[model samples]
Target chain A: MVKLLRSDFRRLWRSKLFYLGITAVAASVAFGLINNVHYKRIMLNLEIPIDNILFLGTLVIGFAIAIFTSFFVGTEYSDGTMRSKVVVGHNRSMIYLSHFLTTTFAAVFMMVIGTAVIVVVGIPWMGSFVTSCTILLPQILCCLLSIVALNAMILLLAMLIPSKAICAIVCLVLVMVMTNMISPTLWSKLEADPIIPEMSYTDSEGVVHTQPEQPNPHYATGTTRTILQLCYDMLPTAQMYQYGYDKIPKNIHLFPLYSVLFIGVLSTVGACAFRRRDLK
Target chain B: MEYVLTTSALSKKYRNFEALKDMTMHIPKGSIYGFVGRNGAGKTTLIRVICGLQEPTSGEYTLYGISNKDRRIAKSRHRMGAVVETPSIYLDMTAEDNLKQQALVLGLPSYERIPEILKLVGLENTGKKKARHFSLGMKQRLGIAVALIGNPDFIVLDEPINGLDPQGIVEVRELILKLNHEHGITVLISSHILGELSKLATHYGFIEKGHVVKEISAAELEAVCRRCIKVEVSDTKALIRVLDRMKKDYEVISDTQANIYGVVVLSELVLALAEEKCDLLASHEQDENLETYFINLVGGGENG
Candidate 1:
């Protein structure tokens, strides 16, 4: 397994996709920070806090990790380089584990690149974090765990699907679905105002009318809110979306635990399925 | 004689289709074992099973005396390398890089033999060109080079010459011979080309419909192969008539070619053909062809 990891890392280092991923992470961070800061400074004449955009890199890193993991690992299947490994006596589980760990490390390493860009490009434009380290550090840690979880999920798709093109398409589509559709929908449901605000209107005849406050039908309350919040926290994509929006969950302690479970369960399932697969 | 690989009643079924059933064969150490079969005859299936790419549905096999069930079978497999159906190489990498990657996988102590392996495969001059740009022949050679990096004693090549041009075929053939004769590498080559395999194989395993039909050493096969006189005549019909009157068994290959079975009296045959107003263009005494030998063993078919 050590040799396998070493070889995989060597390929990762040499892979153009790896460097390209780092560039994409930096570009995404730059894009998000520049777009936000430029918009606020020019139009609103307000300097945003570093806190608002500190997690910007993490948001882009999630997408970068998806594309990188798919192609990096998918190359083995596409090129048939995997056959020689099994032929030379490398256990199938070891192969799976090596890829899982290698891609995880790659995601973390790209996170570092993203963080550097945020500090270099973002801190100058927006002031330093107004939130104290005590509060800020855990949020960053959750972001890392979330990215790792996302990478592991992508690795599962890569392992099960052998065609590089198809695996890449699947990974890209899955991330897009999670980031764009599922996470935002959950947030919308959970963050609905509990009661509608009172409104006043004057008719054309000059008579004033008032509408009393009422319970907002769309608001998720009690158990429904709890389940929806838990689902949002459990999903890596939702975690990244929350980070991007700078919204802390009600139960902030649970995101890391959920990420770990996602990593463990997804990898275990993937390895078992890969073991039973009849490889070409 | 010792065998490097031996399979006993191996079976593999994909859904309801049995690719291999009760297939048994032995590949002796230090011999080029030719695995012959038609398409869909389970040749690749058997190779895949032995290479650990796929598991057998039943029965067992041993490599270097270690059973497949034994954990030590991995150690045994470390001494072998295989190219199944196509060359297993990273097309995006250069030949040198491909070898280096394989060396990393094998965990070789050093890269000293890499240059030698490259020269052996005739890719030494191709410094930075990736495998994607290589000709079919070079890619095939590079695949063999990757296999050789581990310095394994046994190598399995599945249809190595499948799509090579004449020049590529000769180069690959000579390389296979050099590997076996000079390096003493045990080779298990599976191909449908009997004429090509006959030139290199010291032993053979004939398979048909998921089972081995026969296993014979080259020497043994040569001794059992029929003897006949091949003749290219101006009129095969006249020659056939003369042969029938003489009570001899013969087969017509074409309008002007035929093989007379058994030892023939050339002088008597010529006089008989002369009386029939037929001229023999050419005549040669040789052992029955490998294709004929295979057809005789497995019954005539397109592959044979």
Candidate 2:
């Protein structure tokens, strides 16, 4: 197994596609950071929080890293190398595990480097604001976890789908679209109800006047909040967004634990499927 | 002794089509076995199955006397190497790196033998040049070098000479001979190139329609090939009279044709033929080559 992993690692390192992806992601992250800082300084004229800038910059970097991890696995499947791996007497389960580890390590490596570069370069530019280790550390760790989870989800789709490009594009588009489209409406539905019922006595014959009665807006029930929290917790990025950067949840810690479990389960399922798939 | 390799009614079914049907083969040890068949004759499938790439639908095989059903078959397979269909080398890597990767797969201890392996394949001087830039012959050699890792005693090469130049083919032929004769390795080589295989094979397995029709040693094949002498005769009776008088070893093929095997005095034969009122027609010698022999064995058809 060690020997197999060594060979796979060497192949990955020698691959031009892997290096090209890293360079592409690095370039994009640097460009986004430089542009974001310059615009904030000139246009807004307000003191920009380094945390906010870091968070925004890391989000874009995370997306790039996540998409590349998913695409790499898909490319291996389509390129016939995966079949070659099977031919060499390595177990299929080991092959999937090796690939998953490689991709996750690569994703985390890229995310850390990108985040470090942006924060180090952009923080000094801030006039008087000091970066807090308390917030920055957990935020960066959560960001890494979020990217890992995102990669797991995308890799699951990649394993199921035929075309790598189509899989990557569809996964990225769906994640962005679904998170934006569904989260807000679901949040609103979980929030307090605006409408109230007014009851007054009415005379049947004379039609006595009835006065409008205002009732207090009712907040979400504990059960409804728990369900919403469970849904958010099932997604790692949602969990990170809810509790990351030293922010504690007021209602429940359902988001973080659920998302971690969700990501772990998804990753395992993808690995198993990949292990059983016959490469033609 | 049990054969080094044996398959019992081995078969493979692909979707609605059966690629191989109850095919069984026994390959003895220390023989350069030539697997002769046309393209798509399930040669590759058989190789792949032995290599553990595809599962056989029914039946079983044994390698080194261990049954495929045995848990230790995989361990037995470690003694074997194969170049199935194409060389499984990474074209993006250098020849040295390619062999290194294969060595890693086979769990070699050190890089000490890598240079020797490269030199053995005549690829030691490739330097850092990647496999993509290598010529087709070079790539094939690299693939063989990769297979040679871990010093596997048994190697299966699927059409190793296919698509190579004459020089490249000769190089490969010499390499296979050296491996078998000098290193005591067993080679199972499959190819449509019958003539090339005839030069090196110790035994031949002639396959047709996914079945091995004949398996014979080179000595037996040569003996059965029938080197014949050609002679022309006016009449068989006259030829017989001449043959009787001269006591020559010959066969009276027909009234106009005969095969003379022993030496004959032309003047004496002519006189005898004249005395019997017989005339010589025409004579020519014939040597049956491997190609003609193969065509004769399998008969003329699309595969022939």
Candidate 3:
């Protein structure tokens, strides 16, 4: 298993996808930081919260990691390297796990590089955490955990699906959908929470009046709201949405626990499926 | 005789299709075993099963005397390598990097021998060139190079030269021979091109419809396929007597047809047969090649 990991890591280092993903993540974070600095300088209302920047950056980083995982793991099937490893007597479980771990490492590497860019530029432009350091630290950790879980999901899909194009398309679509669905803003919209206008309108008679928007009757309620909340807590993307939007869950540590559980389940299932798969 | 690998009653089925059924074969140590079968006749299926690319639905096989169920079988597989159907190589990697990856998979201490392996496969000069840019033959050779990383004692190649040009085929053929003869490695090579296999095989296994119809050593096949004179004679009883008296090996095909194994003087045989009241109706010499022998053994047709 160690040998397989070593070999896989070596390949990952040389992979263009890995570097491309890293570059993309770095560039995205740098761009976000520069744009935030420009907005701050121009006196725009944009609040560049460090936590929000990091968590929101995951949206782009997650997709990059998805592309990386798909091609990285998909090539095992496409190039027939999976069979070659088996032929050399490496355990199938080991091969599957090594790929998963290496993909996870690649994701973490990209995240770290992206975070570095944020810290370098974000501290100067946006200042430190908007919330307390204790709260911010845990939220950041949860955000990382969420990204790792997302990486596992992507790796699982890539390893299980044999066709490269199909795997990439499916992973990208699934990630995008999951991320979009998990966003707090989307949930808020769905819930139809009343919005209070920031600026009040003045009538022609010089009378000032403010009106709060009514809630949509179609918004989720009762059991549906509870279910969506549960899903939000369980899903890594939903957790990212919570952190990015400053709606940190009370028990944020559970996010990492959920991520760990997901990794365990996905790895076990992926390894078993891969073991029984017939390589052409 | 020591056998490197053997399968007993091995079978594999996919949904409604049975790729292999009750197939049993033995590959002797230090011998080039030619696996002969038509398209979709379970040649690749068998190779995949042995290489652990697929599991057998029933029965079992032993590699280096270790059963498939035994944990030690993985250790035993370390001494084996294979190029099933096509070469399993990373098109994005250079030849050296590919071998290095294989070496790493095998837990080799270092890539000290990668240079030698590349040179052995005639890819030493393919520096920094990704395998995707290589010709089919070069890719195939790189696949072989990957298989040769650990200096395995046994190698299984499924249709190794299926689509190669004459030069590529010769290179692969000579490589097989060198691996078998000079390095004393056991090879299980399957191919539809019987002519090429004949040049390298020390033993042959003919598979038809997922069953091994026959398995014979090269010498035995040679003897069976030797040049012979087919003669139609009247009074086989008289011909047998004359043949026995002349001390020549012969197979009686029917009441009046017999095949003489070696040379025979026509006049002397005719005179001898005449003395015995036997009449020679017709005579012709026939020499059978490997392809004809396989076709005859398995019954000639594309389906076989």
Candidate 4:
């Protein structure tokens, strides 16, 4: 296992993908920081909270992580580089694990560094409104784990998909759509409040009555918050982020545990399928 | 002597296409085994299966007396190296870095062996120059260097000289010979280049349409491909009479021609034929080259 990891690390370090990803992450963070300052200056009322600003920056960083993971693994698969490893008598399981760990670690490291740069740049602009180091530290750690989820999800798709271009495009789309769809559900579950309908109401009518003054609960309440929330709550990513947000009970730490277990299972299944697949 | 690598009824099917069909081969220890075939004749498929890149649909193979079904087959395979189809090196890494990666994969204790392996493949001074900048020959040498990292006793090379210049081909040929002669590494080389293979191979297996049609040693093949004096005689019956008196080994190719597989004194044979009332229209010494022998063995077709 160590041997396999070392090989993958060397390959990843030598490839242009690593440098390109780091540059991309740095540029995106710089852009986000500059854009936040400009937007704040343009509209004095648009007071962006430092926590939300950093959160949004890390969210963009998550997408970058997803792209990096896909390309890193996808390039090898596309070019038939894995053939040598397979031919060299290495265990296929070890190969998958090595790539998975290396890519995931890289994603986390890039995001952390990118986030640090953003925070440093934001200190003068945001003044005292900047996020506290204490809160920001854990958020950064949780943000890294969240980005790992994105990495796992994207890596799984790249392994299963045949075409690199198609795999990468589809992975980004799936992650953007699914993460958007899954986050609010997690927020709703952790906060114990619905994401839509504007207001929760109780009527004091004489007989049993329902308030229909809200923005249609049937559609608005469940679209992003109800059904998908249940689904997201069942996922490890949702659980990990929810626990890290300090919204759930301490006992709910099991979510990250479940997340780890679930990701492990999915990655194993992906690796097995990849192993059985015929290289073109 | 026990065989170093043997396949018994080994077969691999990719969905509906049967890539290999009961390919049973025996490569004796220390022998330079030549796996000869045209493209899609299951050469690469067999190599992939033996290297564990793909599983066989049916049948088994043994490495150094260890059966594929046995748990110890992996341990047995640890002593093997292979370069399948193309050079499998990271193009962005230098040749030395690529070797290091391979060494890492094989779990070598240190990077100490990297220098020696690089020297062996004649790539010692390619320090920090990435493989993408390498010439095709350099890339190929690096691939061989990567394969030799663990000092395996058995090596499989698939068309190692397929895309080389004359000089590159000579370099690879000499390297292969050195490996076998000095290092005692048994090699399985598969190629459609029968000429180059004929020079290096000690044993030959001719595969056609996923089947081993014939397997022969170098000596047997040489005997089968005997050099002969080809003669086109005006009167073939007279030519046979002349040959019968001399008691030489020959084959009657046609009614008007024959090939005599023996030393012939031109004047004596002409005199003998004249006495037998045979008119030798044309005569020439013919040595069977690999192309002719391959065509004779596997049926003739325009080289495609």
The DockQ leader among the candidates is: 3
How far is B7's C-alpha from truth in model 3 (Å)? 1.2
Write down the TM-score for model 2.
0.75
Candidate 4 is graded, for docking, as acceptable
Q: DockQ for all models, in order?
A: 0.64, 0.26, 0.75, 0.44
Candidate 1 residue lDDT tens string, B1-304: 8899999999999999999999889999999999998888899999999999888999999999898989999998899988898899998899999998999998998889999999998999998999999999999999999889999999999999999999999989999999999999999999998889999999999999999999999998875676978899999889989999998888888999988888799889999999999998999887866787788878875552
Model 1 regions more than 4 Å off: A198-212, B229-263, B266-287, B301-304
lDDT, residue B169, candidate 2: 94
Clash list (residue pairs), candidate 2: A233-A255, A233-A259
Q: By lDDT, is 2 or 3 better? A: 3
Which 10-residue span in candidate 1 chain A carries the lowest summed lDDT?
Answer: A243-252
Of the two candidates 2 and 3, the one with more favorable TM-score, higher being better, is: 3
Which residue pairs clash in candidate 3? Answer: none
By descending lDDT, how would the candidates be arranged?
1, 3, 4, 2
The segments of candidate 4 whose C-alpha lies over 4 angstroms from its true place after superposition are A37-42, A46-49, A78-81, A124-141, A161-166, A179-226, A232-258, B229-260, B265-287, B301-304
Instruction: List the candidate 3 regions with Cα displacement exceeding 4 Å.
Output: A40-51, A130-132, A181-186, A189-191, A194-216, A246-251, B232-258, B262-268, B275-278, B281-284, B301-304
- Considering only chain B, what TM-score does candidate 3 achieve? 0.90
Better of 1 and 4 by lDDT: 1
List lDDT for all candidates, in order: 0.89, 0.71, 0.86, 0.76
Candidate 1 falls in which docking quality class? medium
- In model 2, state the lDDT of residue A76: 56
Better structure of 2 and 4 per DockQ: 4
List interface RMSDs for the candidates, in order: 0.7, 2.9, 0.9, 2.0
Clashing pairs in 4: A236-A259
